[model samples]
Target: MTANLSTPPAIPAGTLPAGTLAAAPQPRLPAPGGLLLRPWAAADATVFLAAYRDPEIGHWHTRQPASADQVREWFDRYGADWAREKGAHWAVTGGGGEVLGRIALRGIDLDDGVAVCAYWVLQAARGAGVASRALTAVSAWALGGAGFHRLELDHSTRNRASCRVAAKAGFLLEGVKRSAAVHSDGRHDMHLHARVRDDGPPA
Candidate 1:
């Protein structure tokens, strides 16, 4: 279930101390390929709009953003999410700090010590392993200092590329949830993966 960040939930038993996620100073997280994970800015609304138009992004996430206002609203929501302690979302930026994609740890359930991680890369950056690098870096931070016990990720079984990303980032395949979600195409089964606080990277 989703967390109500406006009122931080009870911390899980083995996770980090209470207020750990809510109290941290927001900043950019350095990553490979000169990538920096930072909060999305209003300036990136156009880029955000462009990325969601990619057929693949629309295929999975469903509902293409029809206007600049929608994207701007999404950007605003990301900020609000952090303020409410509900979750964190970042714009994946390249060396020059151009928005390349987005990555987030959402649906945070503090009492259960879990969050669902998601990412989507711009078409220009697709083959460069941006999603994988971002995923690995964020997962490490979430499980380590953030004091999360587990991070979950899922993709439609049809999304073979995402499955590869999860495997490369050390999340273990749990099982398939039949007809777990609906996409633009139709009802789809979801392949689940997870990483626990003390679990080693999957080989």
Candidate 2:
């Protein structure tokens, strides 16, 4: 028999205050191997555009900015999201400040102390643990100083590299959402993963 999918009953009030995230400046987190996770800048439009242009990124991300102007607009939106406490996005950069990847917490729900994580590494930076390092840094900040209780990550089941990154970053596989995500080719199942604050430190 199919399991019931009704909304669960509401619990107690929010774990954190309303302005918990917005009250503080977005931090520039340090990752392993001299990598840095910082807010996106207006000058990053060029590399931002290039990231979406990559075939693999395009295949999974599915949305692209048509021009530098569009990328700037996206940067603006990201700033607004940060101000509104709805999301947080960061650019993973090398020691020389070269853009290496992107990481973010989307769909932030302060009431529930939860958010979803997303990330992508540039083609040149792949296989160097860039994504995992960025993810681990963000997760630590989110669950520790940021006051978030849980962080969730989901990716297309076919994206084996992403699955590996999640695992390496301490996000345990929760389950699959059958045919839950749409890709360039068609719909595909998604693997859901999560790391809660109580999970303790990463191995």
lDDT of each: 0.85, 0.92
- Check candidate 1 and list the clashing pairs: 5-84
Error of 2 at 32 (Å): 1.2
Cα deviation of 195 in candidate 2 (Å)?
Answer: 0.3
- Model 1 CA deviation exceeding 4 Å by range: 1-13, 16-18, 201-203
Q: Kindly provide the TM-score of model 2 when superposed on the true structure, using C-alpha atoms.
A: 0.92
Q: Write the per-residue lDDT of candidate 2 for residues 15-60, one digit (tens) a residue.
A: 5667878888788999999999999999999999999999999999
Which number leads on TM-score?
2
Give lDDT tens digits, candidate 1, residues 27-53. Answer: 678877789999987888888888878
TM-score of predicted model 1?
A: 0.89
Error of 1 at 143 (Å): 0.7
Model 2 has an lDDT value of 0.92
